[model samples]
Structure formats: structure tokens, C-alpha cells
Target: MDGVILNVVTWSDMYYLDTWGRRQFMILGAVVMSICMLIVGMLSRTEGRPAYDPTLYKVNFDFANIVSAGTAVLALRYLYVASFAIS
Candidate 1:
């Protein structure tokens, strides 16, 4: 690597880097990924969706179910965070 300072390297680095910043990134990424999955999952129901055809996006799942599950998991994580913050 060059002499330039990189932001982060390992998971432990995340621990000392910025707790809130890492949490925010994780939360945001999860949300965006979940949304994208939901959209693609819905499109799968239709015969043809231009953005992702069978040849492109090849994931199989019930969109609503996945969204519900993802939300629940993330929410639980955030709940723990909230609990910690309150205490």
C-alpha cells in the first residue's frame, strides 16, 4: 500500500474508528440493500421487468416476507442500540 492513510481496514478497526459512524453506515447500507431486494423481488413476480431480467438478477424470495424479516432484524439491532443509549 501507499503512504496515504486509508479509512478502515479490519472489523476491529471499526470498533475504535467511530462507533456512531459505523453504526450509521451499517444501518444505511442495510436499509438500501433491503429496499433494493424488495424492489427486485417484486419485479420477479411480473413476466418482464426491464431493470432486471432473469438473466441479470437471479435471486428468489418473497419480497414482503423478506422485507418484514429484514426490518425486524435491523429493528432489533437498533432496539439494542437504543437500550444501550438510554442506559
Candidate 2:
């Protein structure tokens, strides 16, 4: 997903770059990517819980929460990659 997003954005960036201008595009991309990074970091942090379960050898969390968080993190990462590619 990340690779696909990055490739698509990189390929189409010329159109957006021309419309937004270099400085605006860079600033917008940086801000969006930075926000995504912050949210991803918060969601993936292991400070409160060891993300990996020692006994089960998998993520140590409720199945639904883990699935949702993983999805969110993946999406955010993809967004960050696309943003950087465009910038």
C-alpha cells in the first residue's frame, strides 16, 4: 500500500506541484506527514504495554484493538509516504 501510494503520488505530483507552488506544496506535505507520524507513534508506542506477547508470540492485546491499531498505523504510514513523495 505504501509503495503503491508513493508511486502514484510521485507520478502525479507534477500536477499538484504546479498548482500549489513549491513552497506551499512542501509546507502542506510536511505538516500532513508530521501529523501522521505523531499519530502513528502514539498508536504504536509500547510504553504502557509490551506490544509483543511473550507466551503467545504475537501482539499482546485484544484482537480487535490490535487489528484496528495495525490498520490505522499502516494507513498513516502510507499517507506519510505519499505526502513525502509529493513534496
Score every model by TM-score. Answer: 0.34, 0.72
Residue-pair clashes per prediction, in order, are 0, 0
List the RMSD of every prediction in angstroms: 12.6, 4.5
What's the residue-level lDDT of 2 in candidate 2?
A: 71
Tens-digit lDDT track of model 2 for 1-87: 777888889889988778768998798899999999898778767322446778988875332546778778778888899889978
List candidate 1 stretches off by more than 4 Å: 1-20, 49-87
**Residue pairs in clash, model 2:** none
User: What is the TM-score (0 to 1) of candidate 1?
Assistant: 0.34
Q: In candidate 1, what are the lDDT values of residues 1-87, reduced to their tens digit?
A: 211112222433456437556566566556655665555445545433234347756654333534655455445444444323322
- Best of the candidates, lDDT: 2
